[model samples]
Target chain A: MSIDTSTAARVAKLARIKVEDDALPGLAEDFNRILGFIEELNEVDVEGVEPMVSVEPMRLKRRVDGVTDGNQQDKILSNAPDAREGFFAVPKVVE
Target chain B: MSDLTKLTIAEARDALRKGETTSAALTEACLAAIEGAGALNAFVHHTPEIARAQAQAADARIKAGDAPALCGIPLGIKDLFCTKGVPSQAASRILEGFKPEYESTVSSQLFERGAVMLGKLNMDEFAMGSSNETSVYGNAVNPWKRGNDEAELTPGGSSGGSAAAVAADLCLGATGTDTGGSIRQPAAFTGITGIKPTYGRCSRWGIVAFASSLDQAGPMTKDVRDAAIMLEAMCGHDPKDSTSADLPVPDFEAMLTGDIRGKTIGIPREYRMEGMPEEIETLWAEGRKMLEDAGAKIVDISLPHTKYALPTYYVIAPAEASSNLARYDGVRYGHRATLAQGDGITEMYEKTRAEGFGNEVKRRVMIGTYVLSAGFYDAYYNRARKVRTLIKRDFEEVFAQGVDAILTPATPSSAFPLGMEMDDPVQMYLNDVFTVTVNLAGLPGIAVPTGTDKHGLPMGLQLIGRPWEEGDLLNTAYALEQAAGFVSKPAKWW
Candidate 1:
C-alpha cells in the first residue's frame, strides 16, 4: 500500500495533473498515509457482499430519443474559455 | 421583537403574516447583519438588489393573499448551487468569473416559493475539504467562541459559510449540500439544526456535483421546525435531474407532532468509538434520556460496518469527483491555462486542471484516478463499493428489528481552531466518521444541537431515520429539542 515516487507520478499523469519532480515525494507520502488509513477495510470479510453503487436501487429512467430542446448554442458557449464559429475552441489536435 | 434578523424562518413567517413586519424590512435586516459580520466571511457574494426585488414582490403576493410557503424569507445559498446570474464557484478558483445562465432546480424551487436570496455562501473547494480552510476566499469563522477565548474556530465544511451565516443570524435559513456530512457536521459545530434528506429526496439538477451518489441538498436552520419548513420547499421531482425522487413532497413541518411515544430508537454500539471524549458520551446519554422521557424505547443496536464508512466514503466520493471534474478541461467553461510553445490539447488540459484546482482538490483527483486505474480498480474501487453495501445493510438489519431511528453524537467533537486540523488529512477526515454512514445508507439524518462542551463549544446529537422518512426523524428530533431546552446561542462575538 506504500506509494512510491514512480507510482505517484503515474497517478498524477492519469489524473492529468502535472506534478513537478520534487513534488512527487510529497504526493507519494500523502497517498501512502491515505492508503494506510484505508487499509483498515481489510479486517472485515466481504466475500459474499455485493457492491453498492448508489443509495437508490432504482433503474436509470429511460428517455424518449427525441430532441426536446436545442438551438441555444450561444448560451452554452458563453461560459467556455474560447468559442468560435458556434463550437468550443481548443488547441489544435489534428495538426 | 427587537431584531427581525434574530427570528427563525417559522417566526418570520408568522410576523410577515400578522403584518408585524414586511419581507423588505426583514431582508434589509439580514443584509445589514451580513455586512456587519464581514469578519466571518460567511457570504462570498452580495445581491442586495435581487433581495429587495424579491422581498417587495413577496409583499405584493402576501397582500394578494397568495403567498407561498417561503415567501419573503431571506436565506443564504451554498456556492455549490447555480444561482442564475450570480457566480457559483463552489469556493474554487477553477470556476472564477463563471456565471450559470440557468437556475439550479433547488434554488429555482425556493425562488418560485417567493423566497429571497441574499447571496452565495462560502464552502470548501468543490466541497472537498472538512475544514473551511480550503475555500479560496478564506476560512469561515464560527460565531461561537471557545470559553470566551478570542481565538477563531472553524464553522466546519464544505458548507461552512452556510452554517456560520445561519448561526450568526445573517440569514434565517440557508441551503447546504451534504456529501459525507457537509451539512450535518457544520450544523453540529455551530449549534443549529441541519438535516441531510435521503439521497434522491432533493433535486440535484443545479447543485454542483461533488460525489454524485452521496450529495444531497437540505436545510440548515435555527431549529428543528425551521429545518422541516425550509426542507419541504427545497425538494421536488425534476426532469432535469433524473435521480431526483419521483415522490410526493410531504409537508415536513405539519408532520412534526413532537410525539415519539411507542417509537423505538436504536443506540448503535459501534458509534461508541475508543478515545471518544467524555462530554460527547454525556450528551449522547442525555439525548437518550430525553427520548426515553418522551415515551420512546431506547434499544442497543450494532451497525457492524460503521468503522469502515469513512474509508469507503473517501474512495467512492473521490472516484466520482475525478470523473465529474474531467469536464472542466481548458476548452469548455471555467478557468483555462495559457498554452506554451509546442503545447497541444493534452498540455492545455493538464495545465488548466493543475492550475485551476487547489492542493486538496488535486490530491483527491489523483487519489480518485489512482484507485480507478485498470490495475487498482479491483483492489480499491470495487472493494470500497462492496464495503459500502455492507454498511448500508447494517442499517437495514437494525431498522428491520423495529427500530424507527438510530441515535448517536453528530460529530466526534465540536468546532476546533481553524488551522489546527491542517497538515494531517486523516485527522481531518475523522470529522465525518460519525456522519458518513448515514449518507452511505441513503437515509435521512438530522443533527440537533443539545449542549456545549466545557469550552462552551456546542455539541449535537444525531438521529437517523429510514429512507424517505424525514418527517418521522424530525418529529423525534423535535421531542429531543423540547427536552434538551438548548436555548443557548453563541454570544455576538462576530
Candidate 2:
C-alpha cells in the first residue's frame, strides 16, 4: 500500500496537521517509507501466537471500582483558557 | 553554605535531620542555583513561595519527629507530570494552559514524604525527542563541557531538564519518567545515575501518558545510593492506575548492600550493532572488565530478536498514544483554537489540534492512526504485538539460561548536537534503539555513567535485569559504578 499525495493529504488532515503544498511530496515520501517498513511484518510467521499484553506472564492488578476524584476542580480550571459554570466552555455547537 | 547544591539527597536529608540545616535554607540555595544557572533552561516553571512554604512545612515535621526519609530534600519534578496548581503542559502547545485537578502519584507521594518541590523542569514536547531541543520552553543545555567551548550542548530528553538540573546542582535529586530511555539517556548525557524500574512498579496515574505501557517514572540522582533511596519512596501501588501492580513494595534503600561478589552478568552479543561507535564499545568492554574484576561471572548471550524491537515499539507505542491522546479533542482540556472563517464544530477540532500539536507529535499521531486504521490494524498493530512477544521471550530465554542480568550501551552514541537530527525523524528514532527493547520486555534497566566519548560527552553502560529483579540490577550497577569512577561536574557552578 504505497502512500500517494492524496492519501498523504488525507492522513495529514486526519492527524490535524497542516503541510504546505510544496511539502506534501516530502510528507508523502516519508509516509510511504514508514508504510513500506511496516509491510515487512507480513513476512513473519505468527500463525498460532497470542498477542502479548505484557512481557511478564502475570495478570493485571485489579482495583476496586471507585469514583473518587482529586476534587481540586476550581484549582485545575484556573489554567483553562475558557471556563464557565464549572466546566470548559466551547463554541456553541448544538444551537 | 558548603555548596548545598553539590550535596546528594542523602546528605541533604542528613543535614536536615541533624538540625544543622533548615529546609528554607536548602530551598533558597536551590533557587539561587537555578537563578545562577539560568542559561541551562532546566526549569519550565518555578514557584519560589510554594517551595518556601513546603520547606517550612517539612521543617515543622522534622521538629515534631515526624519526618519522612526524604524530609526537607529539594527535588525537581519533570514538567510532564501534572501538579494541581502548576501548569503541566508536557512541553507542548496543545497542553499549553492545561493544569490538572490531581497531582501525579509519584510527586504527590514524594511531597507527602516531606520532600520540597523545586519546580516543574523542562522536557521534550510530549516527551518525544532525544534532545531537550523539542521542548516548547526551549532546549536544556548540557552542564558538562566539550573542552573549553561553552556553547550550549544538549541535555538528552525527554527528561533532559531533570538530569541537567541535578547535574548542575539545581536540585538534590529529581523525578524523571522513562518511556524509551528518557531518564537514562538524559542522565547519561548529564553524567548522572537514573534507573527505569520494572514495569508497573511505579504508578502512572497523573503522568501525561506518552506510551502508556512503556512509561515508568523513576529517580535521577547524582549516585546509586540516592537513586535507591528515592526509588523506594516513589514505588508503591496506586489503585488509580489499572496497570499498576498491587505487589508489596520492597525496601529498596535497605537492600542496597553494594556487594556483588558472585553475581552473574551477561553481555548480550546482539547489542553490539554495526554502527556502534568505537568509544561506546570500548566503554562497554571496560565496564564488563570492571564487573569481572569484582568477581562477577561475565558470559556472552544472544537476544536473537533484538533488531525487531524498534519497529515493534514504533507500531505499539503509537497505537496506544493515538487512543490515549484522543481525550484532548477540543471539547475538554488543553488549548482549543476557535473556529476560523467557514469552519464548523468538526473543523474547529481539526484546526485546533493542527494548531496545538507540534510537528513531531502530529507525526506520531498520524503514524499511530495509520497503523490502527481499519485496513491496517491486523497487518500492522497485531503483527507488531506478536513481535513484541518474541522480544520478551528473548529476554526470558536468556534470563532462564542462568543470566542474572544483561549489559549493553544505553545508547548507540553520546548526545548529538542540539539540532543535528531535527529534520530527520528516522535518525532521531534510532537514538532510542538501544533502550526500547527493555521497555518492550518490561524489564528493569539502569544507565550508569561509564566514561566520556572522544568528543568529551559522557556515555553510559546500561544494565538490564529480569522482571521484578531491580535489587540485583542496582547492586550490580553500584559495584560497576564504584569501579568506573566517572566523576562529572557541571562547567558552571550555579
Candidate 3:
C-alpha cells in the first residue's frame, strides 16, 4: 500500500492542509514508511476480535433534550480569530 | 531558602505544614531558577505575577490552618493543557496567539488544591514528535548530557520541557499529557518519575485534543511519592468530559506502602527486542532482580501482539487526530491566514492550515486522512481498531493470570543529542515502541528512573498495570524506586 504523490496530494486536500508540488514526494515517503510498517497487520489473525473503541464500558452519557445553559456568546466568541455580531466570521462563502 | 526549590512536592508540603518554609519563598526560588536556566528553553510562557499572587494566597491558606496537599507548591503546566488567560500553543504555530478563556479540568483541579502555576512548558508541537526539536519555542535541552559531550541533548518529548524543568529543579513538579509515551519517555530521559494513569482517569475538557482516546494527563515529578500525590489531585470524574471515568478518586499517596510483597511482576519476553541497547536490557534485568529481592515473584509472560502496537497506534491516533483537528479552520479561535481577493472560505481553510501546521503535524494529518478515506477505511483504520482489541486482550489475559504488573524498559535508549533522529521520522516513532502498548490497552503505566547509562545519562523502566489500578501500580513503582536507590541527578550546566 505505497501512497504515491498524487494520492498524498488528495489526502492533503481531504485534510484541508495545503501541500506544494515539491513537498508531495516527502509526504508520500512518510506515508509509505508508516503504511509499510502498518501493513504488518495483515499477518495478524484478528478473526473474532471486537474493536475496542473505548477503554471504558461506557455508553455515551445522555442528557435531557433541553436548553439548560446558553447566553455566554461573548465568552464563546472571545477567542475567535474573526468575530462579528457574536458569531464567528469567515471568508465570503457566497458570491 | 534556595534549597527549598530542591524539595519534592511531598517534602515541600510537609515543610510548609511544619512552618519551616513558606509558599512565597519557594515560588521565588523557582522563579529565580527559571530565570537562570534560560539556555534550557523549558518554559515558553512566564507568568511571574500570577505565580506570586497564587503563592501569596497559598501562604494565607496555610496560615488559616487549611492547606491542601498541593498548597504553596509551584509547578509548570505543559502547553497542551489550557490555563485561563495563559498562552498555550501546544508548541505549535497553528495555535499562535491563542489563549483559552477557560481552564482545563486537570489544571483547574490542581489550582483549586493550592498548586501555583509558574508558566507553560514547551513540548513537541501538537504533541506530534518524539524529540523537542518540533517545538515552536525551539528545542528544550535536556539537563543531562553525555559526560564531556557538550552537544545539546533533547529531554525526550512531547513533555520534554516538563521533564527538563523538573529535572533542572526549575519547579517542584509539572503537569504533562501523554498520548504515546510523551510523559514517561521524557521523565526517563531526565531522571525523574512520571505516570500516565488509565485513559479515563483524568478529564480532557479544555485540553487541546491530540488523539482523543489515547491522550491522558499525568504528573512528572522528582520521585514516586510526588507523582502519586500530584496524580491524586490531577484525576477526578468530570461531567464536562464525557469519557472521564466515573470512579471515586483514591488517596494514591497514602496507598504507597513501598512494599511489593506477595506481588507478581511479569517480564514479557517480546520486549527483549533484537539489537536493543545492552544498557536498557541490563537496567530491565536489574529492575526484575530488584523486585525479586523485594519479596515479589517474577514470571515470564508473552504479549504476542506487542509487535503490532506501533502500527496500530499510528493508524488509530492519526485517524482520530484528523477528525479532532478539523475544527482548526480559519474561523476558529486559532491562527487564520490572510486572504487574497476572490478567495473563498475553502482557500481560507487550506491556506491557514498550510501555513500553521508544521511538517510533522501535516504528515500525520495526511496519513490519517488517507487511512480514513473511503477507499482504504477497512484496510487501514478499521483493521487497526480490531488489531488494537487484540493488543488489549494480550494485556488482559496476562493480568487475568494473576500477573499483578508488567515490567519493561521505558525507552529504547537514553536521551540522544538533538538533530540526531530528525531526518528519519520512522526512527523517532520507534521511541514509543515499548510504551505505546499501554495506551492502546487503556492501562496505567509509570516510568521510574532506575539508573544512568554508562554515559551518565539516565534510563527508566516502565510498569504497566491493569485498567484503573493506578494505586497498585504506584506501589510497585515505589518498591522498585526504593530498591534501585537511583539518587543520581544531572549536574547544573545552564
Candidate 4:
C-alpha cells in the first residue's frame, strides 16, 4: 500500500516521533519505497503456510513466578536522566 | 618481539602458555596500535586502564596455571553490547553518555574466560545500516584501499568496526552481532573471518535489542580458527535469555580438523544472481573447486525462495525493531530531549526520538511502525512472517536431501567508496543479498576470505551449514581456508 504524507504524519504520531510538516513528504516517500520493495512478498502463495513465531522449535521455558533479584535502587537510578526520591521523574501528568 | 599485536589468538595463547610473552606486553602492544590507528576510527571507546588491569589479572591466572583459551587475548567489542560502566551507545545519539550498570552476557562471558577488552568498536546506528556511514562516531574506514586510490572505503556494517579492528590487526579478534549479514558482510569486506551461529546459539540478554529473533553475537577474527575460539567463549545458555539453547557448546576449535572427505557441498544456483561481479563469481567457483579437491562432492542446488529473503527480512526486522525500540522513550536512561514550559511527556518522547535517532534509524522506525499498523498488519507483517517460513523451509528441504553445507559468495562486490550508495536505501540493502538467507533459516554461516577482486580488494566466499552444526560448518571453512591460502594483508594503509 502507498503511504502519503498524511499517513506518514499519522504513523509518526503513532510512533511518538515528532515529524515536521515539510519532513512528512520525505518520510512518506521513504515509507512508500520501502513498502514498495516489501510488496514483492505478495507474489508468494502462502496458502496453508504457518507464520513463523520462533526460528527454533523449542518450548518456551517457564519458571515459578518469583522475584529472582532486586533491591539495587541506587544502581538502577544511576543512569536516569532525572531521578528523584527513589523514582524516575517525568513531567507531571495529574492535576 | 616484532609487533606482538600481529600475533593471532592461537599464537598468543601458545606464547602465553610457554612464558614466551606476557599478557601485559600483549595488552600494551594493542593499546599502542589503537592509539596510532585513529585514522580508521574503528574504536569508539578506549579502555586502557581496564585492559591493563585485566591483563594483570590474566597474567596472575596464567602463573597459577588456571588460564582459559582466551586468557590475555585483547579484543574489540562492538558498541552494541553493553559493558558495565563503559559507554555503550550502539553508535547512536539516542544512547549518548549511557553507560550500563551491568554487562551484556556475551561480554561478561568473555571476561570470565580471561579476555581483555581493548575498547568498544563503532557500528551503524542501532545496527540498521549495511555500511558503517550511519554511525554517530562517523564511518569506520576500511584499512584496505583500492590499489592506492586513497579514497576511504567502508568496513561493512553493522559490525563494521569489529571487522575493521580485526582486519587491521588492531586487535586479535572482536565481537559482532548479526541480524541480517551484519557480521559476515563486514568480515567479507575486510578480508577476515566471521560466523553467525544458528539462532538461539548465543544468549541475547543484556545486548541492545535489534531484531530479536535474528540477532546473534559472533566473533570477527583474523582467521577461521580464531573465529572458532572466540565463538566458543561467546556462546552458552543463559537463564535470562529464554531463547538461548540449553545444549552444551562444543569445543569449536578442537572440531577444526580441516577434513571434508566424502562430504556434500551444495552450490545454490539461485545465489548466482544477475549482474554479479565477475570476481565474486570466480571466487565462488574457486571455492567449490577447493572443496571438491578436498574430497567433497559438489552439486548444484536451488533455494527458490532466496530472492524473497531480503524483502522478508526488511519487513520482519523493522516490525520487531519498532516494538523493541519503544522502550527508549526518554526514560530511565539515554538521551532525553529538553522540554519547554508546557511540554508534556508525549512531547518529550516525540522530540527525544526525533532528535536522537539518525536518518536511517528514523526511516526504519517509520517503516516498521507503518507495516505493523492496524490496517496493514496482515498484509505486511503477517504476510512477511509466512514468507519467512517458506524461506526457512527451502533450506530444510536442501539439507534434508543430504546437503551438508552450501557455498556462495559472501557479498556481491568488494568494499565500495564511503558515500557510494547513500542516495538509494534499496541499493544499500542489496549488499546483503547473498548472506541474509542464512539468518532467515536460522543456520550457521561463515565468511572466509578466499580471493581478491581486480582492484586488489579482498573478497570472500560463504559456507552455510545445517542447523546447530556450527562445528561442521567451521570445519568446512577450515578446509577452505587451508586450500585458499589467503595470506594477503591490507599493506598498512592507515
Candidate DockQ scores, in order: 0.82, 0.50, 0.81, 0.88
Supply the TM-score of chain A against the true chain A for every candidate structure.
0.90, 0.74, 0.88, 0.93
CA lDDT for candidate 2: 0.85
lDDT, model 3, position A26: 85
Q: Which residue pairs clash within candidate 1?
A: none
Tell me, by DockQ, which candidate is best.
4
Clashing pairs in 4: none
Residue B190 of model 1, lDDT score: 96
What lDDT score is found at residue B397 in candidate 1?
A: 90
- For candidate 2, what is the TM-score? 0.96
Residue-level lDDT for B82 in candidate 3: 91
Q: Residue by residue across B351-433, what tens digits does model 2's lDDT show?
A: 77877877778778888988888788888998999988888988889888899888899988877667788887777878888
Tens digits of per-residue lDDT, candidate 4, B285-327, equal 9999999999999999989999999999999999999999998
* Cα lDDT, model 3, residue B48: 98
lDDT for model 3 comes to 0.93
Native-contact recovery for every candidate? 0.82, 0.40, 0.87, 0.86
Better of 2 and 3 by lDDT: 3
Q: Which should have the higher DockQ, number 2 or number 3?
A: 3
